[model samples]
Structures are given as structure tokens and as C-alpha cells.
Target: MSETKDTFFDFKLFKRLFKFIKPYKLVFFSLIICVVLLAGLSAAIPKLTEFAIDDSMTNKNPKDFVFYVTLMFAALILQTIFQLLFMYYASWLGQNLVKDVRINLFDHLLSFKMKYYDNSSVGVLITRAVTDMERIADIFGQGLFMIFRDLLTMTVVFGVMLYTNVKLSLIVLIMLPVLLYATRIFQKYMKKAFEEVRTEVSNLNSFVQERITGMKILQLFTRETIEHKNFKTINERHKKGWLKTVWYNSFFFPIAELSASITVGLVAWYGGLNVVLSDTVSQGVLVSFIMFIPMLFSPLRQIADKFNTLQMGMVAATRVFKVLDTTSHIDDSGNQIATSLKGDINFNKVHFSYVEDEEVLKGISFNVNAGETIAIVGATGAGKSTIINLLNRFYEIKGGDILVDGTNINQYTLASLRNQIAVVLQDVFLFADTILNNITLNHPEISEETVVEAAKAIGVHEFISSLPNGYHYNVKERGVMLSSGQRQLISFLRAYVTNPSILVLDEATSSVDSYSEQLIQNATDKITKGRTSIVIAHRLATVKKADKIIVMDAGEIVEQGTHDELLKKENGYYKNLYEVQFLQEKVA
Candidate 1:
């Protein structure tokens, strides 16, 4: 987010990206060869014109003029052919590179702990993977090729001009310093403008994504007008940023053009004077000098423009690398795999904090035997969710070891540890896919029969069967097409499909109707019958069936007992919570 002009061309990031192109080395080399050939043919065209003027025009030889004209046309044709090949290869390479980078980035993102998603915006992350990667691809495909072509053409033209007419070449060379200085200034403004553009774009993307996703909340609050006005303000800022970039580019092109023209003009004046005064240089040579001067500056202008593009691309690349540079707070440290988990979970005097020096869970310890169903109840922010998060290894405990099956959880690969756990959250999220796919996310290799069995076990198969497409019904984004209870049912089915040793249901039925809640309770009871289950619920009824109830308040466990024992407590948190929910149910 900072606009500081740090070095955007990160060599490490380039090295990683370059590895993706290694498989297409031959195509890459061929493209470079084509670019060189195109540059050579382009540089030779002006020389051909010079030959036509000096040899054919001066001598009035129609045959020679026609032959040279034909040769020039042939050169143009070859140039076009090679240019096409170069472009095709460049485009292919760029697109493949983008694809590879995106795939790798996506995989890397998945490997990160859930905490990364908690701290970052989905919209900005999506933009980095799609838009920013495309911008970098454009640089690799077009910008780098242009830089090479222009450099080659400029070098060849200048060398040829110097050899043919040293004095005039020297006069034209004077413009180089001025061009370089102007470009230096242009790059400064251009880099700043480009950084601003990327910032504005990221902000706009975030705003749009938030607005769309929170449309329901906006309607509930009747704040659509306020949201629209905010969006308009963001739009105006983006427009202003874009216009500033455009104006800077507008000034840049003309400065480059005027400098090129001035260089050509100086050459024409000095060359004509030398010829008129001493007759030392022939008319043909003077004419060639005039033509070559413009040819040389044309590539110069291209180089300037390419440099501007490169700067912009570097800005995008920096943003992308920032994401890649973030270190995952939770990472797998062990290569060991637990062949089997007995689900004996132990929290040994654990301490944790989202921020330094502020512990959320302090010196807490608990243990649960295999196949035991434990319920965690607490006031809001009483660290109930945080405890479950630790059990899932979503956040590493700052101080103490969490052991599974009498072995430290960190002693096993994260995948190995997580593979044994299944979670069903209150706010269930389903991908845009068939109902069957959502339930079968964990076990895509499972047969359709198995999918139906799992759905039926969760009491969702009947509802799905009633739909026109049954299990094949498409779940729109975030399962928007399904009701909340239906989403919860599908989520439970998904967890069941995984067949995990440890089950976590975090308020899994809190948002559902009574009927759906009963369905979920039945399904959860069946699924957790022989698994180590941790259920966090706001609705006390859901946890009454739990084997052991642990009450938490302000990050510490206040009480632990069976349902009957907790009910007998005079003023315990669980008893109070149960009374409140019971009164609410009676009122309903």
C-alpha cells in the first residue's frame, strides 16, 4: 500500500517465474531469433531506400530501380512473416507463463494456514492472481520483445549511419543525451502514476467486492443510497488517478517526438549545408543521411514507450510479490505421518495471543478420550472458537504443546494432522457446483452411491431428491440458491464424507429452523457416535446431549460437568444459558 519507489524488479520473483518458461525454451529462443531477423530487415529498409535514391534514381536506370523496389518489397514480406511468428510465440509464452504462475500461486495460497485468509481480502487476492498476473504477462510477451527489437534496430542503424556519413551521424548523436535526460524525468512521473493507478484499481476492486457480497446487509439496513454514494466517490478517485496517468503519458510522447524531430531536422540542415558549400558529399549520400536519421529516432521513441510500460509492469509485479512474500504463521515442521489417530487430544498448559503480549487463551489445559463428545459453551469472545481453532491447528499456540494420541501435533505433517479432522461451521460456504460435488468435496473419488448415502445420512437427500435435478442441482455462489438449513445440511454431509477421526461442529445448527436443527442434531449424533467430537453451540439444547460440557469465560474454563450435573449448579454459566434459551423457546 505504501507508494515508496522501492526496486520493483525483484530478481528472486523473476527467477521463480522464469522457471515456468524453461519447458518452452525452444519456442522462446525461436521468438528471439525472429525478433532479431525482423529488426535486421527493418533496419535494412532505409538503406535500401538510400540505394534506390543514389544508384537507381541518380542514374535514371529503370531496371535497377524496379529490381531494388522488388527487393525492398521482398524484405517487407519476410519481415511481416517473421513478425507474425514472433508475435504468435510471444503471446503463447506469455499466456502459458500467466497460467503457470496463477496455478502455482493458487496452490501456494491453499497451503497457507486459515489465518492468512482471515487477515486478507478475497477481492485483492483474486486481483493479484488474475489482473496483476496478466499485467506481468504483457510485460514478458510484448514489453521485453519491444525492448530487444528497438535496441537491436537502434544499434544497427546508428552503426550503419556512422559508417556512411560520420559527420552527420555525430550531429544526430547529440540528441541522445537530451533524449536520455527526458526519459529519466519521464520514468519518475511515469512510475509514480503507475503506482497510483495500481493502488486505485486495488481499492476499487475491494469496494466492489465488499458491496456485492454485503448486499443483503445493506438492504437490511436500508443503506443502499449510502453505499451508492460511497461507490461513486471511489469511482471518481479511480477516474482522477487514471486521468493523471493519461496526462503524464500525453506529455511523455510529445517530448520524445519533438526531440526525435529536432534531431532529424538538425541532420537535414547540417548535411545539406555541407553538400551545398563544398560539393564534398553527393546528393545521394545526403538523401540517405536524411532518411537514416529518422529511422534511428523511431526506435528511440519505441524504447521510451517500452520503458514506460516496463515501469508500470514492475509496479504490478511488486504488488504480486508482496503476497508471495508473506510467511505463513502456521507451517508444517515435521515429515512424520501418524499411521492412525486414537483421538486422545490434550491441551497442555497452552497459551496463545493474536497480538504480542496479549494472550487470548492463557495456560489452559484439557483432555478428551477417543470417541468422546465434548461441548464448549461461553459468552461472546470467551475464547471458545479460539480453543476449537487451536484444536484444528488454525493458529499455533504461542506457548505449549497440543498432543494427539499422546504425540505432539506439531510433530506430524500439517496435512497428516488435518486429514484426521472434519469441521462444520455455522456460516457454511458451498462452491458453485452441483449439490453432489459440494458434499463430495473431501472425497471426489467417492462413488455417486457413496455421495447419496452420505447426503441421506445427513437427512438432506430427501430435499435434494425433490429438486428438479436432485443431487445434480447447481449450488450458486456461496450456495445462494439453497436455504440456510439446506446449506448446513450439505456442510454436515461434506464433513461426514471425509470420515475424519475428529469432528468439529462450531454452532453448526445455530442458524437453522427447529426442524432443520433437529435434522442436523440427528445427523451429528450419528456421525459423532464413535469419533472425538468438539461442539461449540450458542443454543444450549444442541449441547445437552454432549458427553461432557465445558463452560468457558474470558479464555478460561469455569466449569466442567455432565448435562445433569451442570443443570444442578445454582448459577453456573451453562445453567443460566440453558434457562435463557428455555424461556425463549417457551415464548416462541
Candidate 2:
């Protein structure tokens, strides 16, 4: 999955984003009205100044001068008030739009399948959610408002100037083309620079996040110096990207300033000649024309600056859309829903692979009768967990069919299928929340009594009770605050809380100490009672209690029988595994 290279000004993306603003149209229209009013006031300022110079100052009319001055002040005050309203409404609308966009994005992301997350990076997705969304908000709030005000002011001022003096306006207008050309060129370069900057910033954030999350591993290996060097490299790359953006901005502003100066100088020279030739046009009108030239160019310069911001915003939008545009490889096609399930599982000629032409499970067949426990033992990467993943429909099988209760698993709604199956993985994960919350994660409606009962059934309630806040104790990110045993216990309780018809325990007790292992073994015995279960374990003792044991090797099931039956196969994989563990027991 490659990041999108599409530009930010993509019409389709803007059209999609504009939908978020539609709900707040009334506020948006009010903002536009304020902007137009402010622009009209801005253009009127120079005219008022011109009137004061011609009639009040030249003719020496004190009462008229005072009156016009008061009117000018009143307009200034009105512009300020309208400007405040414009800012308030624009901010309100932008924030509301951002909230709406984020909610929609999050809802869509949650509906995506596991395959989507498998191909995407956590850091990149997080950047889109936080940083990219913020940039879009800033553009909608500040950039859009400025664009509207500057455009309206530019148009009105130019019209007035052309009407008052056409020749001078023509000269000033010539500079407009130059300004537009310069802005166009700058916009192209700035787009690439901003994209690079955003990429580098994402890289820096990824590095920092990984380092902090893996601080213990770095310290254990004494790799602080190497980590420091790696961070420095990322930091330097970000700095270089920033420097490039600054360089382009440096060139952009100077060109804009020079263009403004030339336009003003041209207007002054042409208007001055007109005044010298005849007294038809007042000195006030000439002064006003000069003022109008900068007024016109100032907005042009602003548009130039806004062009840069708009490009940056486009870059951010491109990133955000990339996440939103990703197509999930796995999708639920069936509409079947079941209120309950009888766990009769069958894997008929199952063939599977993570990638094409690389078979992980080949021609595998298995069956588990309702209310039975089966153990699948295999060497590392021998497809033990792959079998469990397929059973849960986490990854679709490339060939063959898996059925539950004589119906193909794919024929069932994904939610209904998953709700009936619970998995306790080898590497247990717990959210940074209360113990009660973690256990009740799948069933928030379950009462505290149910949570406590589930935790007690898993032998975790006693430990949780010893905590400072009991079940309400915060776990810290990824349950880092808890012991490995405690985390495993919580995972067990979570699966148990679901009361799933079919339970899959993949190395569920591997990481815990012997004391916790005994507790887990007892808990498993209780939980697996009368429930169809698949147990994947490395420890021979754990599978010894299973009703049936299947051994796998090289993507094929090599042997299948009860524990005693497999132990009797003198040369089989299961026999060898039993011998190794039995010998280790003797040595201990």
C-alpha cells in the first residue's frame, strides 16, 4: 500500500470535504457577509481620506472636516466589529466541520477489516487523524476567510480605481499579471516542499514514538548511542525539509514585495502626470489612487501567502484521504445472523497462505464435534495459529471451506461469527483502562457482578482485589502497569466474559510464571468444559489433558490421536515432543 501522491487541490477531495461545511451553511454565509462588509469598508477608507484632503483640508472647512473624520472613525469601528464577527463564525464553523470529519473518518476506519490494518502503519494513520486534520481545520478557518476578504477587497478597489482614473489603473493592473505569474510559480514549488515537510514530520514522529515505546529494549541492549544517532538522522531530515520551505518563502515574499512597490510607483508617476497637465482631478483623488494601488497589491500579496498555505493544506488533505480511500481486502459478504451457535467445526481440504505461491497450510482437514476440546501442536511457524485465525475468519482461506454447525463460516455475518468465537492469543493485549473495563470490553452492558465473576473464574479477581483501586485500577498503556501473569489473567477473563460457544487459546499460558500457569490451567479446565475448544500449546503437559491431540509439521498434519495414542507412536512428531519434555522433567 503506497501513500497517495495526489495533490491537495483535488476537486473530488474538496467536494467531499465541502459536505462537512454544508450543515453549518448559515454560519458560513454570515461569515461571508462579514467579509464583504469589511472589504467594502476597507475600500471606502481611501475614498474618505481623499475627500478629507480635497474638501476639508484644501477648502479649510472645519465643520465638514470634523464630520467626515468622525464618519471615517465610525467606518473603522464598524470594520473592526465585522472583522471580529467574521473570525468568531469562521472559527466556529471550522471546528464544527473538523469534528464532523473526524467522526466520519473514525466510523469508516472502524468498519474496515483486519487486512486494512495489516497493510497500513499505525504512525501514518495517527498522523492523518491528528496532524493532517488540524491543518485542514486551520485552512478552512483562517485561509478560507482571508481568501474571501482579499478577493472581495481586490475586486472592489480595482473597480473604483479604474472608474476614478483609467490610465493609472491600467498601469497598476499590469502588475496583477506579474503577481499572478509569480504566485503560480511559487505555488508549484511550495506544494512539493510542503509534501516533503509533512513526510519528514511523520518520519520524525514515528521514530520518537517507537523509541519511547521500546525504551526498555534499547536500555537492555545498551543501544542508547545507536538510538540517539538514529534520532539525529531523522531530526536532521526534518530540519532540511523545513529549510527548503523557508527558502521558497524567502523568495516568494521578496518577489511579492517588489511587485507591490513597482505597482505603487507606477500608479504615483502616472497619476502625478495627470495632475500636472490639468487641475481637472483633485490632489485628493491622486492620493487616493496611490493608496488604492497598495490596497490592491496587499491582497494580492496575501493571496500569494494564502497560496502557500493552501498547498500545505492540500498536502495534509492528500494524506487524510489516503487513509479514507483504502479498500479493505476482507469484507463480509454474508447477511446471515445467528442468535446462538452450536460449535461443530470442520476444515475441509483447507489450503491457506499469507501471500501467493507460499502455502502455509496445505490440504489440511480437521473436525471438532460439538462440546469437545482439541489440541493442535506444531513447531514454530508450522501454521498452528494460522489454523486458529482461519477458524475465526480473521484471514480468509485461499482454498477449501470451514464450516460451523454444517454451515460455511463465510455464510454467516462477520459480527455473528466472531461474537460466537473468542480467542486468547499468545501475546495478550489489554487496553489502558480499568480491569473491569478490560474484562467487560466485548460486553459493556455486563454488570460489575458479571465482570467480577469472570475474573474470579480466571483466578485473576484475587490479584485485582490486591490493587490500590481494585478492578478500577488503571492498567497503563498496553497493561504495562500489570505483571505478565496479571495481563494474561485479564485476557483470559475477557474471553471468558464473552461466554463464547467456541474458544481458541493460542499459547495462552506461555508467558506467565509457574504459579500463574497452574491458575490458568485450572481456569482453562473450567472454561473449556462443555464448550468446543481449540488449544494450541508448546507445553506437552498442557495438551496431555486435551480430548484429542493433532500434530503438524511442514504445513501438513503429521499425526492425530488422543494423548496416550500419540505417545504410543514411537517415531511420530508428538512422540518425540513428549519424550523431550519427559526427559526434561526427569532431569529437573
- Pick the lDDT winner: 2
Best by TM-score: 2
lDDT of each candidate versus the true structure: 0.82, 0.83
TM-score of each: 0.93, 0.94
Q: What is the lDDT of residue 270 in candidate 2?
A: 71
Per residue, candidate 1 scores C-alpha lDDT tens digits across 1-588 of 334555434465567667888988998888888877887887788778878877899899989999889999999999989988888788789888878878878888887778788788888888898888888787777677777888887788788888888888888878877877876777677778777888888889988998899999999999999998999999999999889878877887787788778887887788778778987676777777777766677777777677667766667777877777777857688788966687898989999988779888888888899999999888888888898788778888899889999988888888888878989998999999998888887465777899888877777788889987998899889999989988998898888887889999998988998888988888887998988999997665667778898888888888898889998999888789777775577466
The C-alpha RMSD of each candidate to the native structure, in angstroms, is 2.5, 2.4
- What residue pairs are clashing in model 1? none
Indicate the residue-level lDDT of 191 in model 2.
75
Mind giving the per-residue lDDT tens digits that candidate 2 earns over 345-442?
99999999887899999989988999999999878889999998888777878899898999999888888999899999878888888888887884
Q: Which runs in model 1 stand beyond 4 Å of their true positions?
A: 1-17, 269-279, 583-588
Per-prediction tally of clashes: 0, 1
lDDT of 2 at 401: 89
lDDT of 1 at 579: 76
